[model samples]
Target chain A: MDCISARSKNIKGKGQSKLKRRESLAGLLFVSPTIIYFIVFFLLPLAVCIYASFTNWNILSPNRVFVGTLNYERLFVDPKFWKALKNTLFMLIPIPIYITFALLFAYACHKNILGQKVFRAIYYLPYISSIVALTLIWMWLFNSKYGLVNNFLSLFVDNPPSWLSDPFWTKWMIVIMISWKLIGFTSIYYIAALKSIPKSYYEAAQIDGAGPRQQFFKITLPLLTPTTFYLLVIGMIGSLQTFVEVQMFAPDGGRGYGVGTIVFYIWQKAFSSSQMGYACAIATVFGLFILVITVIQFTLSRKWVFEGN
Target chain B: MKRKISPVRIIVFIILLIGAVTMIVPFAWMLSTSLKEANLVYTIPPQWIPKPVDWKNYIEIWTASNLLTGIKNSCIISVSVLVFCTFTSSMAAFAFSKLSFPFKNAIFVMLLTTIMVPLVVLLVPLFVIYTKIGWIDTLLPMIVPASMCNINIIFFLRQYMTGLPKELLDAAKIDGCGYFSAYWRIYLPLCKPAIVANVIMLFMITWNDYFGPLVFTHSESKQNIQVAIAMLNSHYIQQTDIPLMMTASLIAILPVLILFIICQKYFTESFAMTGIKG
Candidate 1:
């Protein structure tokens, strides 16, 4: 009765109060589930990770010990941290080359040359296969004594290097496996980007007497700036989180932190060592590290990522 | 991608062909070795062909242990995850793309921000929470997380939705369809390609992932196929005179590869929506 009277009185104001409040209420109700989920799952978990970094909270523990800055202090001095950081950097080295190959692969398929569908399916196999299985296969393939790679090399080179066993070779092996897995999906992305570039652009360039080489450089490359920029940002972020390949492939807990990329190192600390506090700290730092890079990438993309419009 | 199809273009094709072959060999090798005798697996030049092809590996692996049970467990987990993720994400995508929700931009931004937080960062803390809920060693930990709509998937559906003509939606509303009804009757059918891609991608992730399955499952009966394959040394890889490991690997990757092959077209298209399109 009170609500009815209020609405009826507000009717004198005209054209407003009858549906306005109800529409606002409906909108709130509609978005509530997703908002609740984000708060509980995404936001809360992040907060927990950040706070857990400051305190020693093991899964088995009865209570968290407030360790304060100790986790942070230990992370800085840890040589393993330095090695993992280096390994993480090395993992990113081949990404640009990988992206180039991806573009070539995409362009090939886009142009409809040479059993294109078959080729894309073939390229995409590794990406979709079980990573653990793929890593294990790579692990066996890199076997120093009897593996496929070394065995092939032995017909010419005397002592084919121990790819997984050695620290230096371990980095290369990880890079190769990572590249093999990602190239196809990324290629598909490039193929889509290529297709979106209408033929009119190329026709216009050709009429201006621009040959294929000149057309690619002047037209194709420039228009492709947005896609490439997107690839770089996502690719870098993805590569930095490269965990499973190292976790499974480079054995002996990934060779004394040699191939222990940031993620692998976190796994080592949290799961292997039971240093939950310090692991969370590493994860927190790593998150911030990635956050900074992504912010820079997004900022850069403002100037770099071109609008199709 | 340098230039036109010259003599160099032919050379590029050759190089790409070789690379593609290399990409596929691991899987082909996996399948072939599955049917071979164990002794032939490590032979010179890594035997491409096996003699007296032993097909018993599949039966031995499946029947000698609780692998069939594990396979069943994996299927249950993966299918459930797939259904939940697809349904929830499509709904979320609908809300983001169509409905005039309050603070939609803010919510979208918040969702996108999580993509930067690597899986590593979330794993430990999430582990802690799972342990609290006594979800360790059960499929719930893996299954539940799979439902938490990823930003990439939502954004993907959103982009595809954005490309769709708004008139279809407006016309539905004019004929008295509400938001959910229009989404169900209109967008659902039109977005079939994108939805299929999303399902295939998520299904592949769940089906092939050893990471979550490794942590969440422990018993051989609870193990997924990848874990089963990787832990070959324990299961049957050590059993000489059989190609059991190979058989398991082949069985493990078959479903996902088949799905990927089936959805290859849509996968390529919707994947482009994510990035790399001009």
Candidate 2:
């Protein structure tokens, strides 16, 4: 019996090791499909965008000329570039306002008050809803002559301004629409972050004579710093890459370069103007900008986003 | 001090309720407009309630705009992509979580870094490649890329898998199960929530993605709902029969919304997971 057991031990050991190796190999094999897919679709295209950045390759023209930094030069001198930057910033400025509101909404939800779930679902529907639907609704709602928003506003003032027609109001309407769409998603993050803080802390705060406002400022806000940092990083990236909404809203936008972000500008240059090289340069610069901003944010996050300490 | 559920709170709720109503009203308006007579849709001091319903516009768009074909194309593409992406990712995730792979960390890091690469950069090159391969119009671009060892899915499932009990897997192995058997029987069933969340996210993404459809698909018959609807309202939105366009847009969004409503917990959890994990 002892001899039989010993023989089985050695056989089992060898078999198991072999199985492990095979399993690992199979795992690698399974993932290779994805790696290859990424290489062909993502990495190769990325390489082209980089290479194209250094040349004047337009899809329209057969012949391509090498031009280093000329596209960058053109971007710097162009007023449209600044306008695009301004438009992006203009859109971004409202994020903090909405985020503050989201935090409040999340706090209200976290309180587990009456009808919390209903409020949550109501607010959150817009976030998950197709942007196409949201945009269409907003377009109708913003109609100059007869729209819901204007009609609602007319109740207060004798005449409601033509929001869609006016250039100044058009971007603001877009920002308002985007922010409303975003707040629910943002609020959920805060709610999650809020939920994670052991209830004991808040209970203890209450014992220590901390009021609602005091607890919020001292405990809730500080703990949510990490969430805020994360949201900011993602928000900046999304705002920078804000393309589709602008494309739909400002198809025939006003003046030079129209009301667009850097991404929109790149889209126009690449697809519309057929200046692949110029677009690539814009992409490179945008990528660099994102990199720098991200680095600074992560560095700054050390002070506020306390993962452990 | 801010009031808690007082008259002020009631007032605030009323205000926010109004806001929420405004937010939700569009869908109702879209539906009504779709049902209303075409002439009644554009009337001044606009008729909130029309005298007669017009099913003809819905019929017209469905038939004239090739919406059925568009919807069929969308369903085929989204479902296929979902299956492929889910299968490949879970298999890859099985390895990441349970098995000991050499050079695993390095490969994982490479995938993570690629997440930052702007998708726009891939546009021109993929266009050339797809055109060369004669896959420009077909659904290959959408499906092939949709399924694969998605880095996000891998990480998500990895985190979920690692948290699972080692005992379950060990017991399975002890019962004469191979690694694949243990993975299939033990791990995959446990990771249902992650799979559900991932599916919902992917559905929303693939369904709503305008760019990929715009570039890859040309014919209205081949296009997804997003592309098809865009073609309907592209050149001039206001000039179009506003009611019909709005209804079509609502219809386009309905599938994902229905999915989301059913899986609200997963959707919320997914968003929460991103924050916590990131």
Could you tell me every candidate's TM-score relative to the true structure? 0.90, 0.92
Which stretches of candidate 2 lie above 4 Å from their native place? A1-20, B1-12, B234-239
* Docking verdict class for candidate 2: medium
Q: Model 1's DockQ?
A: 0.51
**Predicted candidate 2 versus true structure: per-residue lDDT over B1-278, tens digit per residue:** 33367764565566567756755777677777767765676677667776776677777777656567778988998889888888888877777777777788777777776767777777776776787799999988988887775777778888888888888877887798876778778788889988899888888888888888877878766888887777665345345777677768778878988988899989988877866776
Worst 10 residues of 2 chain A by lDDT: A250-259
- Candidate 2, residue A222: lDDT: 87
Which candidate number maximizes lDDT? 2
Q: Which parts of model 1 have CA positions greater than 4 angstroms off?
A: A1-30, A300-309, B1-6, B63-66, B165-176, B233-242, B276-278
Q: Highest DockQ, which number? A: 2
Model 1: per-residue lDDT, tens digit, A1-309?
Answer: 999989987786564553445444544554555566678667777888999999987766779989999889999999989888888988787688788888888877776776777888788788878776676566556777657788888999988889866778878887878787888978877777777788999999888999988988887777888878878988898888787777665544455767778887887787778888899999999999989988888887878666668
Residue pairs with backbone atoms closer than 3 Å in model 1 (clashes): A193-B277, A193-B278
Candidate 2 lDDT, tens digit per residue, A84-122? 878877778667977887887787778654566878888
Query: What TM-score, to 2 decimals, does candidate 1 have?
Result: 0.90
